[model samples]
Target: MQKVFFISDHHFGHKNIIDFESRPFKEVDEMTTEMIAKWNSVVGENDKVFHLGDFSFLNKEKTKAIVDKLNGYKILILGNHDRGRSRSWWLDVGFNEVSEYPIIYNNFFFLSHEPMYMNKHMPFVNVHGHIHGQKYEGKNYFNVCVEHWDYTPLTFEQIRDSVVVSEEQ
Candidate 1:
């Protein structure tokens, strides 16, 4: 069966990201290569990936090249750093879809590029990125940023399971 995955804050070709996020890699090339490998390891060509933005700081061609090298059908939720580009530009670079706002998935999960304020009364779990390494305490909020998730794409099932476990507790 095909799977759906979520990840964010790749910031490919952004050397400053290493210092900004305290990422382990020494350079942009190394970071990008490792992230690509990790993504391909779990994401098959047929899988669907929801990338919650800050995808790259490279030129259009370089960004397209990175996108082409990755596996899965990709969708993008634009983040703060993802501005200054048109939706058509993102689509042309390989994103199956691009959105400027939050999306509701499966009628229960809210997908956003940045973590939105949500509570149990909201009726939908918020799955978001940004805020990098900070911990979010709510049972209905899930962070999928690369820094928080070891730079690997997380399956919807994984996020759901965590929600289940949190609720049970």
Candidate 2:
């Protein structure tokens, strides 16, 4: 069966990101290659991937090349860095769809590139990516930055289960 996955903050081709985020790889090529391999390992061609943002730091040509080799139907929610490009540009780069703002998915999940404010009174969980290694405190917020997930895409089920576990603790 096909699944839905979430991930962000790839920063592909950004050499400084290694030092900025303290990423394990020593080179951009190695980082991109490993991340692509990890992404394809869990995502299938028919699966849907919601990439919260900061997808790449490469030129349009290089970015498109990388996106073309990835698995799944990709959807991007513009991150801070991604705002420099247009929705059409992202589509041209191989994303099936691109959004300039947060979207509500499955009725109760609010998806965005940056964490959204949520109180106990709110009914939605914020599924976002940004802040790199840091995350907001609360089960209502879920960060899918590649750094937190071994550079692999995370299935929605995985995120749901984590929230459930957190609530129980």
Candidate 3:
């Protein structure tokens, strides 16, 4: 069986976001290249990747070209950018999206995306990346930053063991 990973919000080619966040890439090509390289470094060809949406910048062809070079099965969770990207004729080359996934682990069901309005009350931990380091001042939740295209997914075990628990009022 192949390994699985998850990532989200890699808004490539958006110079405005890059400038504001001080992204290392000077251009889209550079960002895409780096992201692919980083992903390959940690993930394998048969690995599974769950992208939580906002895949790229510009047209779908531009984004698809970059993702096609990667070695893995990518599943998108469909963020706002995907609305425009779906129209891109070549967007399908890299990813597929699904509504919800119910995976059992840690004696609970791990759900993804779709803003966990009541996640705090749920028995399982909601693994997501829509929010950066914002929200939930202190919690064991993981916020994968869209620093570069180089993003990796954290597993349930990793979250259960490594995430720092925060006090919620």
| Alpha-carbon runs more than 4 Å astray in model 2 | none
Cα misplacement distance, residue 78 of candidate 2 (Å): 0.4
TM-score, cand. 3 vs. native? 0.74
TM-scores of the models, in the order given = 0.97, 0.98, 0.74
lDDT of each: 0.92, 0.94, 0.58
**Compared with the true structure, what per-residue lDDT tens digits does model 1 show for residues 10-67?**
9999898899899999888999999999999999999999999899888889999999
Give the best candidate by lDDT.
2
lDDT of 1 at 15: 94
Tell me the tens digit of each residue's lDDT in model 3 across 50-150: 66666667665666677777777767666665555343343365565443343333465344443354455565555555554344432434454555233
Candidates 1 and 2, the one with greater lDDT: 2
lDDT-based ranking, best first? 2, 1, 3
Error of 1 at 4 (Å): 0.4
Q: On residues 5-65, what C-alpha lDDT tens digit does candidate 2 reach at each position?
A: 9999999998999999999997999999999999999999999999999999898999999
Clashes of each: 0, 0, 1
Report lDDT (Cα) of residue 143, candidate 2.
93
Give the C-alpha miss distance for residue 113 in model 2, angstroms.
0.5
- Candidate 2 TM-score versus the reference: 0.98
